[model samples]
Target: MMKEQKDNLFILVKSLSKSEKRQFKLYVGRLGVNEDSKFLMLFNILDKLSVYDESVILKKGIVKKQQLSNLKAHLYKQILISLRLNPSHKNIRIQIREQLDFATILYHKGLYKQSLKILDKAKTLAITNEEKNIAYEIVELEKVIESQYITRSLSTRADELIAQAKDLSLQNVLASKLSNLSLELYGLFLKTGYVKNDTEHKRVTQYFYDRLPEYDLHKMGFREKLWLYKAHLWYSFLTLDFIACYKYASKWVALFYENKDMIILNPVFFLKGNHYLLEALFYLRHYKKFKETLFNLEEITKEKWFPLDDNNESLAFLYINNNKFNLHFIEGDFKQGLPLIDNVLKQLEKYKNRIDEHHVMVFYYKIASMYFGAGENEKCIVFLEKIINNKSLQMRADLLSFSRILNLVAHYEAGLDYNLDVLIKSTYKFLIKMEDLYDVQKEFIKFLRGLGDIYPQEVKAAFIELHKKLKQFEHDPYQSRAFLYLDIISWLESKIENKPIDVIIRNKFESQVLKTTFN
Candidate 1:
């Protein structure tokens, strides 16, 4: 009895769209004998099943128990082949590979001239699309063919092939190194979050610069430069350098704009670059620029040629909607943003299999934040509980820590203080366990802990005192990240001023806009 998650074939069958399943059936039916084959029967059984029960599969009489594994594997491969033939799945990379496959077949059949011609066109297309690895493969194939089927210009052709291969190989190596460094930094950011103090900062700085490969910018192509910018962006993020993040993210997005055609060829990277740019702007509180960037991204997605594949669609939904929430947060219009929660949640459910748990939790946190700002403390607590109670969400320790802290605040605001002491203790302990107890969090917890002891008449004074204390770290490199997660200062101001949290935040936003406008 294989676990549902571990059953690859079952998962694949379940993931298929109706059109895709129809195509698969038609693909198998093309071979009249395969219409009733054991593998086809297995596919049908897996497709109809809501759960991957090996015993149920055996009872279906598709194949013998001992032979089931082989049959499942065959079905998986055939389904993939069908998908590969689907027109929507045939992007430039796949097209290039298809050409390479055709060339390889021809080369093996002694059609050397024909093979060389196909390889030449494929190498050009690959290079144009910045698929350097495949371009190198095409060049290597051409060289092999040239050695066996010599022409009058063999000497010059050999030199040209060798040069192209060398350049492509170098570019691929550089891209690989940069991509590896970027992935490592991203993993570190996820595992422990941003560097907490100067010691962690120095360690991460050293780790980043040590692995960052040297390359001449002028000589680098789109693929190499894309990875280079990504590495820098991750490094800036880990070091809590918002300006640097903006710089690298801007460069990343600009690279695509400079080469507009590459946007279609590398839509995922384009979407990610824009997302990071928006994130950096959000952190910087650059409202004008953030709005402009978000608008531009939304418009880009609406363009005629933009990809609408499932993966791209899921990411577009994730990044665009996530930032739309951020936009509302920056403007302090949480009430207006509340309507978006239902749609976002619906999309999250629709793409649950595509989006990861970490992002889903982030969405929950944003929803909770919106509710909190809108003065809907009970609603806020409900969403925060989703994140706080997620025991298996191991990534984004920072998010988990803030979710608990926000949960405590929501409870206090809603006057659910009967269990406040117990909640405070658990949250403090959890923060300590996560090693995420920054000064801001400590101050917050300390204030909440003493709330029960304060007289009702002195509560406003307590709020003012707590506001003064937390305001000092509003710009602190390490501690300020906590404020980005939960805007305690505004919450305190709302309490002291006897106003709603949204009113306080909206006033602050208006003042900042005025200041920016005057400046």
Candidate 2:
């Protein structure tokens, strides 16, 4: 009678909830407290251990295909009946379709919000039916969404989802489910947004950040593991998250540097170089000690070859930024750098894929600046046209800056005969809309400087107004354009009322014009 009564109690516990069911499993499986008390304590304990191990094996992807197939066959039938009764419970269907359909789409598209939304709606629908049987499935899918978001540094939603997933995953004999979810969360964090934001407010939500390394070190065999370090490095660079950036970069470098021979052909090297260059640029901009490291990096990069695609093209952009720094700030033979720029663009173009559209536009922009600097106006105009025509270039602040400068140069060289007014006005409009007032003033200065040579007092007043506006940014690096302004001033001042033009101004103008013929 006692044994039969215990069996009835066990059946009641199993139907209550997942958490209650787990408590029952633990009490029965671990404490040797079976309904059938006929067994010796040790025998009951051993049986419980066997059941625990069986649960572990089932959870760890170790179950036989036939066994899972049989289990799934029965479970699906129950799930279908539950769904039929509570068809409105999207959470039920989402849970069942997670790994199979609905959740997979969310994962593929990086849409975590939609995944959880579907699961929550389904859960609400399932509440009406006690036998929904979707409790386990919903729990697992919810965990995946939560873990994935947490790993990606989508901290805004992570904490809430994690709390909910953890509660559900830990319910009942869901230890195996919890363990799998934990591993996945750890792995996805490593694989995606490994680094959190640089700002203080953003880091507060990450509860599991500290536990990740412990988890990662244990599951190092996972292929996507390497990407965790890479993602962290990229995130650091993106958010300017320096301390974490350096920490992860050192870890990543150490990982590959020792086994450099093994992964020399791997895509990670390009990723590493990208990391190094970006970090170097950050340190080079903000700190001083990294210069020597930056110098040695150039040598390491020389030994490496890049394929002509997006990754290699990123290296090309790094080269462009570094070269611009060298040209404008370092005070070297800027012309000597042109060959290297040309070589990179040629390599990118060799791929013949449109993936390099932005890179190519950048190349054209740089070349235009270089030619304009050399007074090769016609050549500058050709490259400027390339930049203006590329449809892929996003009209961001940087692109707007480049566009305005190029347009000013193009219009000045094209002269009034070419209806250059249209180009100049369009450039002014773009800069004004972007709130790039400083560039707009520079364009105006260039325009007045170009025309001030021909029309004296009226254009001279325009130049004076531009100089007044420009004076505000006197320490600005772009004030270097003042050199041209000075030249224009000198030329205008040197002109006598009756003189044809100063011989010196004529000579300077002719020399500038001559360079354009073959450039």
Candidate 3:
């Protein structure tokens, strides 16, 4: 049996809308083919399947084992051709490529003049759209045709094409190197998360500077600038410098807005740039700017021409809702955000096939945090257990560590202490295995472990003492992330003041806002 997500044909079929399926059928029958064509029959069979079962496909007798492979390949190619012909799928890049294909055919048929005309138009369209790599190919083809067939402007044509090719090649090389560097930095962030200390920080800084290209910023084109900012954004994120991350992410999103036409052509990059920008604002506690950025993104995505295909729709839902939840956390209004939890979980199931495992786990963590802030300790434990029990999550060691620490805290809060000893021991062992024990975690676990020894009258004093100790780590770069995941300080304040946690956080935020305003 083929893995459903890994099976390209089945996934594509599953992704098609009702209208697209109807169009595919109409396209297949346009040539007056027999209804029983093997490829068409195979397509219908595969489309109807709930999963990719090869045995069931073979059992249908549509094609023999030896012929099944050929039929599948044919059906796949036909589907792509049908999609390319669809108006909804046609973009500037696709249109330029189509013209290039036609020009190649004309050249092979000895129609050199017609081919050259089409190539000229196609090359202009490609360059206008920043499709420089394809434009370079067009220039190369033009050079070959001029050399083989005499033209009226032969004296200047070769020189013009040569200059264009040289410029395009340099731009393409810059884009390629910057894109590769950006991808590597993203991989490093996913694999290990933030740099743990001075040693790790220096190591990551060295790696990033080694791969970064030297360039004149003003001379770089839009594509090159986008990749350059992306590389810098990821590097800043890995260093846990939220301010720098915001700076680069703002530049990235601004580039698209400055060239408004690029938004429609490159919707994915635009959406992602806004997502990262919102994330940085959230971490820096810029509640006003975070709200502004989020609202702007929502408006842009809802535009009439913005692409809302299934894949992008899933992404919009993910990024938009993730920040929505974050906003509630920013104001510490957990109860108000409760309405979004069920809706987000339902969409998670709907998009399970498309979203990755790591992202899904991330959702669970956010949900658990929401429940924790709402003071529903038992429910918080339930959600945290989902992250705790996930054995396959290899990336994001920070999330795993925080989940464990939060789990113990939730257990202690809910008075579910019968198994607390066993849970704390397991968490300690895992922390040692990961070597990610920050001062925050060490003190948190130590406090929880000594709960049985503290006198009832001295509990408030104990809370005050622990709160004072954790305050120092709140400013420590590496340790601050632990607090971001679980606000132990606010929880302790609530205990000492005999007030709700959300009230404590909201009051504190307002006071800080006033201080900044007056200053």
- TM-scores, all candidates, are 0.95, 0.39, 0.94
Q: Across residues 403-424, which tens digit of lDDT does each residue of candidate 3 receive?
A: 9998998888899999999998
Better of 1 and 2 by lDDT: 1
**Candidate 1 per-residue lDDT over residues 36-152, each given as its tens digit:** 788888887888888788999988776898898898888999999999988878999999999999999999999999999999899889998998899999999998999999874
Instruction: Write down the lDDT that model 1 would get.
Output: 0.91
Error (Å) of candidate 2 at residue 366 is 1.7
Model 3 lDDT at residue 12: 80
The lDDT of each candidate is: 0.91, 0.46, 0.89
Best by lDDT: 1
List of clashing residue pairs for candidate 3: none
Error of 3 at 194 (Å): 1.2
Candidates ranked by lDDT: 1, 3, 2
Model 2, 1-519: lDDT tens per residue? 422222222222222334433443454456554555322222223234412233433444534645754544443343344433332333333444443356557756989877777767666544332213354466566767677676545675567556655544433223333334345543443333222223422452253344333333453422233445655554454343456667766666566555554233343454454455445444433223244445544555545442333344446445534444333222223345456556655665543332346545655666665554444567767777777766665533545455555556455544633655566567667656755454435545465446634554575465455556555554443332333222233223333222222344445445644664556
Candidate 3's C-alpha runs over 4 A off are 1-6, 49-59, 64-70, 153-155, 516-519
| Pairs of residues clashing in candidate 1 | none
